[model samples]
Target: MSEDVLSQGEIDALLSAISSGEMDADELKEQKQEERKVRDYDFKRALRFSKDQIRGLTRIHENFARLLTSFFAGQLRSFSEVSVASVDQVPYEEFVRSMPQRTVLNIFSVEPLEGRIMYEVNPNIAYAILDRTLGGEGKSSNKVDSLTEIESRIMSRLFEKAFESLEEAWGSLVEIDLTLEEFEVNPQFIQMVSPNETVVIVSLNAQIGETSGMMNICIPHMVLEPIISKLSVHYWMQKEKTKSSPEDAEHLSKSLNNVDVEAKVLLGESGVSIEEFLKLNQEDVIMLNQSIEEPLVMHINNEPKFYVQPGKQKRHMAVQILGETRGEEE
Candidate 1:
């Protein structure tokens, strides 16, 4: 076929026009809109946790209560009454102090640091609960005006326990042992930040016999990113393991190799009355009367292997390989 060719000048003119913004206006607008969408892309924020992770956290919380309950068995009416309101992913510096007019107690906050998760613990009631549950650890109290030191110790221990649980649940996926710094009456205006740039908030709402309030534990997002990723990977691995198990994989390969082979076996005889048999004591032959020449039924892994006449293998019962059957009788 003869080629339809363009001259060098023609190609040069076309290139010059394209470089000089000669494209159709509508096409340019469409392309620009697509690019703009990509630039403006931002995922909506929400709370999420794997079932195992959530369960781990919940068990930790329960254990925390148990420890406290054992510490103050009769002092407090109920020592374990905190509920996790939410575990959310949030932007740094977004949390602010509660409104000045709002007389809220037990507000807590935390900011990420280079090697620590700093916590801001506030209010008297929350600290009181912590103190009662934590008990005294060789440190005597003198009824001080502020429980700053006591609150710090209690919160530090609680967060440390939580970190330990996280580490145990996720193994190397989560790095624990970061310092847990705590304070009392820290103003919300002061910013606590993390080097990792992201963190998780486990907000606990304390419902103590009608006196309700909330507290928070902020954990670095970087500390949990690896955990979340590993959870996803572990889930997929479990699914694959289940799919590729020895029995299941063998069955699948067998199905692919021979579609005509059936894996089920059928009983030749149905249920009959056992009481109808003659009741003879010694040397009585209550025979089944099955033919010796009949091929013996064989099974493999609880499925039919083959049917063959009974044979002897060094005085042990054995079977000879016969034609593969699916309990079909002609």
Candidate 2:
């Protein structure tokens, strides 16, 4: 064997050459294409969400804005105005299709392959917000000016805040990320509803009057599915919580103990003339002279409780207790 050893660079070159054979250029290309296809399909399908989910998410944003407005009401020379810009639908693939224009400039799209709710920001609105947040330190006040680095950073922070507000208000159930996508002015976006596709578009714009720009919130349809399902489940749960079966609604009664009390029983034989009762009004007594062996009716809590006879409990009034009182036969 030769005592001479291969140089590090030569050995590296040899290893590279050997590995290159295992990955054919054409086969690698095909594999990459397959992966892209799978990813694209997933993106398209994952872009949808239900209507209730959109409302829930919007509520989150509203609550977040309210908190911010309250916190910085004084130092905040600027305030944001929010609005729903557009709601529309497109084929999942069509929405994600790449455009062929713009030769020199790179027009790469960051949109997911699924259909999306495209949100736009009024640059001026963003500037106003950013100026108040990141503005005090040598920031431009130009309404039409594109976002500066500081402005972008401030906007990023605000967006993150908005996302968090959404989660907190909605119970941390969804994940959301912002992406810049290629937008086209499509007439379909203006229609009131899209039932065929079952796509819901919700746009929330936050604008500062000082700056003419705004922030756009685009929620895809897929993000709302869980919310919708959850709402339905909640509604059903509420109904179930209040529901009761006939057997479960049956009422039972418990017997009450007897209490002795004396009552004067007026039998049919005891009679007083109307003339005699009227003539002897003051200090006159109409008495029912009955036998001492007669049982007297007893009352408890102002109701007829039972039948009992007079008895002695030292000096207190008492009665011989009878069986349970009849309560209209159940």
Q: Which candidate is the best by lDDT?
A: 1
What is the Cα-based TM-score of model 1? 0.41
> TM-scores of all models?
0.41, 0.35
Q: Tens digits of per-residue lDDT for model 2 on 179-272? A: 4333323323332224334444334444454444334443445544444554444554564587566655543212212444455422315677
lDDT, candidate 1, 142-232, per-residue tens: 2324546655566556545434433343333334444434433444533555322445566666544334456565555544554454545
Q: Alpha-carbon error at 136 in model 2, in Å?
A: 5.3
Model 1 spans with C-alpha error above 4 angstroms: 1-115, 118-155, 168-191, 194-274, 277-280, 287-291, 323-330
